[model samples]
Target chain A: MDVETLVLVHQLYGAQSHYIDEGRATEWAHTFTPDGEFHSPSYPAPVVGTAALAKFAEDFAAQPGVTRHVLTNLHVTPADDGLTARAYLQIVRTLPDSPPELLRLTTITDHLVRHAGTWRIRRRTVRRDDTKENR
Target chain B: MDVETLVLVHQLYGAQSHYIDEGRATEWAHTFTPDGEFHSPSYPAPVVGTAALAKFAEDFAAQPGVTRHVLTNLHVTPADDGLTARAYLQIVRTLPDSPPELLRLTTITDHLVRHAGTWRIRRRTVRRDDTKENR
Candidate 1:
């Protein structure tokens, strides 16, 4: 992929993490397309569309401790449809007066498209590293 | 700065981690300039020059257990002389029959220059997150 697209993808991931961490559900959901879809091992069914995506972010942000989605090792490539991005996600959590914990490690695969001159995720799939399928 | 330079810097970090993880000391050291320097709070003094850099990598690899350098949140900017890149580093270690542990978290700052058509680190400074300065 061209350097510009790659940087944009990285920035998009950063924005996603920041929005969700700050409990900005609408903002976080908007990082995806209007009809964006999210599939994850943690969810029984894929979350589809803007409203559902927003609700998903809301539920996640409602959890007890502060969380950070640390993204790393991003690999980006141009695809026939749009752009394909794969990254490692480390979810760290911490509570008041306690050391931060490495909550989970997972891989994120994203299909992104440029809509109205801004890159947005069309689909995202997450696989947890500790899961049986991964092992 | 420009996207192409940004991509090269990210790739350099990936190569650095891979070479050190596989115990390719010379290769890892070569990722830096001939007179590259590394300063870390864990060490009493800075490691300088290609020879010392190689020795540093060798010493790190000699330690027991498998280690992976997880790099994240890279921020790159153009400096007067070269590119300045900052990234979060998570040193994860795993031993036989044991789950991986996040051994340390640190911040890495690198001053990089283009030499012989390749990006090379001129200097790298590492500060541990658990250290007094960070906390």
Candidate 2:
């Protein structure tokens, strides 16, 4: 990856975390493509398209307490003749309280494509580290 | 990074995980440089040098139950004039037995250097997702 690509991917990763943590559901949904899909272990099926994706984000943000999503260990690689890229990311959720407990650890595999000169997630699958059902 | 470099880093990452998961302590330690250091939130200080690194690997292998360190979401960037690279990796530990439970989730930041034609980790610091002290 070139320095520019690396920086762009980093920025995208950071933006996703920031939007989600701040409960900006619309902004978070905008990070994905129009027909993007998000699959999590917590959900039986994936949330697809902008409308469903926005709804999912809104529901998550409505939960009790504040969450700080800490993302790290991002690996980005090109795929399918450079039109798309695959990235692996780690997410650590922190609950703000008296002690600030760590709530969850999840790994995300993102399939991103360049849409309108910017990279947007086409598909994102999340696997919880504490679960055995999803690898 | 070039395609060759990206592939090389991925191979190195895979090798380290495979060796450690299979209890190949010597091989796992060999993935590091002679003066490499491994630091984790679980330890008070960093484990330095090849001998110490080997010891630490052996100790981890002797733990109860089997552990599969699933590594993903790796982002590698050039550092120190391209002679070294900084990579971020996520590790999920899965235990074997009835139900096969998920053990832990940790993130690793590795500093790798090209030594004698191969990439080796010079320093690796681990941060647990469930921790508050080590940010």
Candidate 3:
């Protein structure tokens, strides 16, 4: 991918993280396509479609404590359909009167597409690095 | 900053992190200019020049545990001379039979200059988030 594409994708990651963490459910969902799909062991089942995605993020926002997604080591590649990318994600949570906690460590794979001149996630699959299968 | 410059600066962060974590001290030092300087509250004094930079990283390389620099929330702006950037950094360490630990949390500010068509750090200042002054 060209530098412009890489920077755009990186900004997408930043936007998604902030939207979700700050309880902007609709904005977070919009980071994805209308038919975007999120598959992860953290969730009981895949979240498909914009409505479902928004609801999923809303539910998390309703929970206690603040959650911050710390993502690192992003690698992006050009794909026939769009762009494929991988990144290491660390979910950190800080509660009142408690130290920030490391909630989960996982790897996220994203299938991104350009929608209306901006990058959006078409599909995202997350795998827990702490799991036996990953090891 | 333009997307291209943003991408180059981001890649510079990636390169420096890998080189230092992998104990390539000289290579890590080369990520900066020959007269580069690093100032951090973690260090007793500022490390200046190529030789001092290499030696600083070399000493860290001799440490026992594996350290990974997790950087996030990068913001870059064009400067008169080059580019100025800031990022949140979390240093994580893992030892034999132990869970990965959050070593430190800090904010890094960099004055980056283009050297030979690639971005290199001219100066870097780091402030610990845990410090009272920062809080």
Candidate 4:
């Protein structure tokens, strides 16, 4: 992936926090491709399709006034097929001015594909080696 | 961050899925530093410190026979402060040989600090603008 393409996708990823922080649920739903998928073991399988994705946002909006996503240790590998990435993510949910409580997460690993004219999550899998809890 | 560190960290991140999938709860607890933390808005705040974090793992182990984390679209900003990363993560859970289901996640944005000797979460946040539901 070109630096700019990577940069835009990266920016979209960062905006996840802003989406919840602002409670802009619809805007939050726009981050993925219409057919893009979302995965998290805490729940079930991948959420595919825009309609279901929108439902996901509505549910989150009902709780946690504001949520932020932090990622670090980003290592991207540009491959002939796609860009391979490895990152560590920490999620925090805040209520107005409260001290954010952390939601536990271990690591993020993936393969991204450039589809049509935009980059989409062709296939992604998040793996964790260890886990922790918050007080 | 050097390519090796990036690779190692990525490998660690990818292991998140394996940790849960294999039900190696303790191994899943080792991903962070003694003071490493995890963040997810879905929760209350950041899970700082190993002890509290370990509790987090135990809770997750109670369910979800196996969990996988998938990260995509990683862009790293090597700042003087540290390595800043942005990524999108998807998690899946499987029961024995059952089909994995998707969990809702938006994006991961973070700032990682290289601790005294190794890389730690430093600070992490997960953001979501959109969400999806699984059938």
Q: Which candidate is the best by DockQ?
A: 1
Question: lDDT by residue for model 2 over A1-135, one digit each (tens)?
Answer: 565775677688779867877889998998898999998876889899989988888888887677676654455767773434333333333455554544555557778887878888998888654565433
Q: Residues B22-117, candidate 3, lDDT per residue (tens digit)?
A: 578999999889999999999899999999999999898777766667777888988889988999888876564445678889998899998877
Order the candidates by TM-score, highest first: 1, 3, 2, 4
Q: Estimate each model's TM-score.
A: 0.64, 0.60, 0.61, 0.45
Backbone clashes (count) for model 1: 0
TM-score of each model's B chain?
Answer: 0.96, 0.86, 0.95, 0.73
| Model 4 lDDT tens row, B16-123 | 557745667666656666676678776887888767776777777677466666565455657677776666666556789787665544566666677657555665
Off by over 4 Å in 3: B1-3, B12-68, B72-89, B93-100, B104-135
Candidate 1 colliding pairs: none
Better of 1 and 2 by lDDT: 1
The per-prediction tally of clashing pairs is 0, 5, 0, 63
Best candidate (score: TM-score):
1
Query: What DockQ class does candidate 4 belong to?
Result: incorrect
Give Cα distance to truth, residue A132, candidate 3, Å: 3.1
Q: Model 1 chain B, poorest ten-residue lDDT window?
A: B92-101
DockQ score of each predicted structure, in the order shown: 0.19, 0.14, 0.16, 0.03
List per-prediction Cα lDDT, in the order shown: 0.83, 0.70, 0.82, 0.60
lDDT of 2 at B120: 87
Worst 10 residues of 1 chain A by lDDT: A126-135
Model 2 CAPRI rating: incorrect
Model 2, residue A67: C-alpha shift (Å): 1.3
Query: What iRMS does model 3 reach?
Result: 4.4
